[model samples]
Target chain A: MKLRVKYSGQLRTATRCGEEDVGWSPDRTLAELIAHLAERHAAGRPHLLSDSGAIRPSLLIAINDAAVMANEANATRLRDGDVVWLLPPIAGG
Target chain B: MEDTGQRSELDAAERNRYEWQLWVPDFGEAGQRRLKEATVLVSRIGGVGGTAALQLAAAGIGKLILAHGGELRLNDLNRQLLMTTDWIGKPRVESARRRLRELNPHVEIETIEANIDEGNAADLIGRADLVVSAAPLFAERLAMNRAAVQLGKPLVDCAMYDLEGRLTTVLPGRTPCLACLYPEPPPHWKREFPVFSAVSSTVGSLAAMEAIKVLAGFGEPLASRLLVFDLRNPCFETLPLRRRPDCPVCGPISRPAP
Candidate 1:
């Protein structure tokens, strides 16, 4: 399946693009999606997941317009045509 | 005539002020009447605060107390709707009070011509059912949050930049306070940022809507969540937030509620 990923603010600068189309598998989650991109796009980047495979606090992840709470596993089981948005905690007034 | 709650007794003519809202499913004459009884304090009527306060007053939130210290300047007209070109040299609170009272005479308007701070935050927040943080600086924002937390008042924080806006509702100790989400004011958060009047209005309206929902028992109040908007790309997002264990104002204190 295919999933569309979106980015904004300062993260867009680092990702070097606002959005991308990526291949997906039903078995995967948001953490898997970013892992795939981080590996494919840029090597040596700090992994998004912890050693225990949890989303790191520095990065904020959203699935289909909802922010992931710290306690919840942001990596939900993926479905075809899912929309994902990634944004780091950027500072603003 | 029923008390309508506040001293501002609803006359036969003023009853028509809420005809549309009163006809809604759950918000009938009683709910509309409930709104007329609630009091909201808007801290520092500026870009975001002025717009939110205006909406609350126009929506007939019975009593509104506005706190703002600065005098209006030509530069403030960009996003401040309460100030007009004619009011440039006047104090901001005066213009904000005048515009708010003019919108609905039924709304009892109170003015606090002082900036909210650690010293006086509680007294101003004490009188209101809900509070709006429209003040520019985070020092003021932090003060408002602390006051709201101390009083256990639901706080609606409206903020905008460039063409984007973000809103979040703080349910005192139940949800995350401003300090939880932002541990401290960011170094880059300057007083003036790129903002459009429409964006400020948009955030302000949403803030007022949240206050309305909290006050009248309407829809979801966005409790414990942060709603961020990017009008440039028009993306609306909500992030679930939990109280930080070490947030200064909202952090862990080994004491119970006073």
Candidate 2:
């Protein structure tokens, strides 16, 4: 399956992947896709996941314009031509 | 001061003050009066909230409660337009009040030289017809969310970092609250982040518009939707937000006592 990933806020600079097209195997969870991306980009690994390999709480993942809750990301499956948004929370007022 | 709920008819001067906006279709003297009768609370008068408050005042909001602590610094000049150089060492709320009052003296302005917290969030939010949560900390945002939900007041959440900004409007039980989006503060979120004045102010102005629309029933607001703008990519996305059934703040409240 092919997916388009976009990073927002500091994640764009940290990941150096403003928007990219990636190929993934079928039936992979959103977490797996994140882990895959983290492995490929050394700079983005720490920003995308914690030491325990859990998705960072501050990062918001939206699949096709629907935000997936942190607790549900591990179980949410991805599909072909899906657009994933990696959004880090912007805390500044 | 509390809203006395007594609204006098719009005088000729008041009508002239909002002449341009009054011409907006479906938003005539009635909409202007609604603005004059509404009270809004803006948290942390920084880049985002300062712009939001300024727009609210310019639109003739009846009352504004500005909450923020600490003195302004020279570094805040880039985006915090409400702060003047002379007021650099003064409390942020004071600068915000000065600028906002100068824009529209008819709008009642109240200042709180303290940040929003669990202790005072309820009281501050309860007094307003709506809230604009532009605080830099999720702790403050969540506090405002809880208070706004409990009080059943509308809240406009605005945030910015780097060249990116996002805004969402919360309508208590009808829409998702801040807590519904992030059940807990993102562990990676820090107090300081990169931000441009343009981005923050852009989001701030949009937030003010959302609040005005909600308060005056002028247009369709972004209820239950998050609008994210990435100035770097120059892209804008509006994602639908869902209310969590298990949302601790807004969920399980059932209905307000009739």
Candidate 3:
């Protein structure tokens, strides 16, 4: 399965690319996809996961423009061609 | 029918001053009248808040309560439009008040030298019919959100980083509040983030428009939707927002009839 992932705000800066298509195992959870991307993009690893390898609570994950709560992100299963967006909370005035 | 007495009457001078906007189809004299009677609280008069306050005053909002604690620094000029070089050491909110008053003398301007906190958030938000949350910290933004939810007032939140900007409106019980989106402060968020003047003002201008729409009771507001934009890529996307049934801040409040 291939999933399209888009980055916004600081995540875009860290990833050095606005979006990319990542090939992943079918029926894999979103958490696995995030870990794969975090490993591939070394600069975005810190922003994507904490020291304990858990996804950061502040990272907003959305599938097709619908918000997924931080806690539920790990359990969210992905399908082929799903579009995921990762955005970090930005508060600069 | 709206309570004309509470909305107040627009005098000839006021009508003439806002003649162009008054020509809007649904927002004719009625909308202008509502603007003349509404009081808005804007937290932090830096890049986003100051710009939002300026547009609100220009739109003839009856009163503005600005709260920003800090003296102007040389670094603030890049996006803090309300500050002048001469007033570097002076309080920032005063400069915001002065500039806003200069834009529209008819609109009342009030300044508070301190930013919103848990202790004072309720008091500041209670006095205004609507709120604009533009503080740079999640702590302050969440405080204002809690107060707005508790007081049953509308809030427009403006934020930006680098070339990206975001805006959302909270209609208390009817829509998702700030806490619904961010249940807790982001651990990695720092006080200093990259801010381009253009991006900040863009979000601020949209925030002011959202406030005006909510106040005037015309046009569609950004309730339950988050508008995110990236100027570098020149892309704008609206993400659907859902209220968390367990959201501590707004979950218990009963939704009012539309």
Give RMSD to native, each candidate.
Answer: 5.7, 2.7, 1.8
Tens-digit lDDT track of model 1 for A7-84: 654445457666888888888766667767767655213424445645555455567766554345444776777777
lDDT of 1 by residue, B74-189 (tens): 98888789898999888898898888777888788888888889998998898888888887777888888888988888999887666656788988767778877655454434
In candidate 2, what are the lDDT values of residues B96-165, reduced to their tens digit? 8888888898999999999999999999998999999999999999999999999989999999888888
Candidate 3 local lDDT, residue A81 = 86
Question: Candidate 1 or 3, higher TM-score?
Answer: 3
Task: Estimate every model's Cα lDDT from 0 to 1.
Answer: 0.74, 0.87, 0.89
lDDT of model 3 at position A77: 92
After superposition, candidate 2 runs with Cα above 4 Å error: B1-6, B255-258
Instruction: Say which prediction, candidate 1 or candidate 2, comes out ahead on TM-score.
Output: 2
- For A1-93, candidate 2 gives per-residue lDDT tens digits of 899998876678787768999998668889899989889887777778888998886577899988887678889998899999988666789
Model 1, C-alpha of A66: deviation from truth (Å): 6.4
Off by over 4 Å in 1: A1-93, B1-9, B251-258
Stretches of candidate 3 off by over 4 Å are: B1-7, B256-258
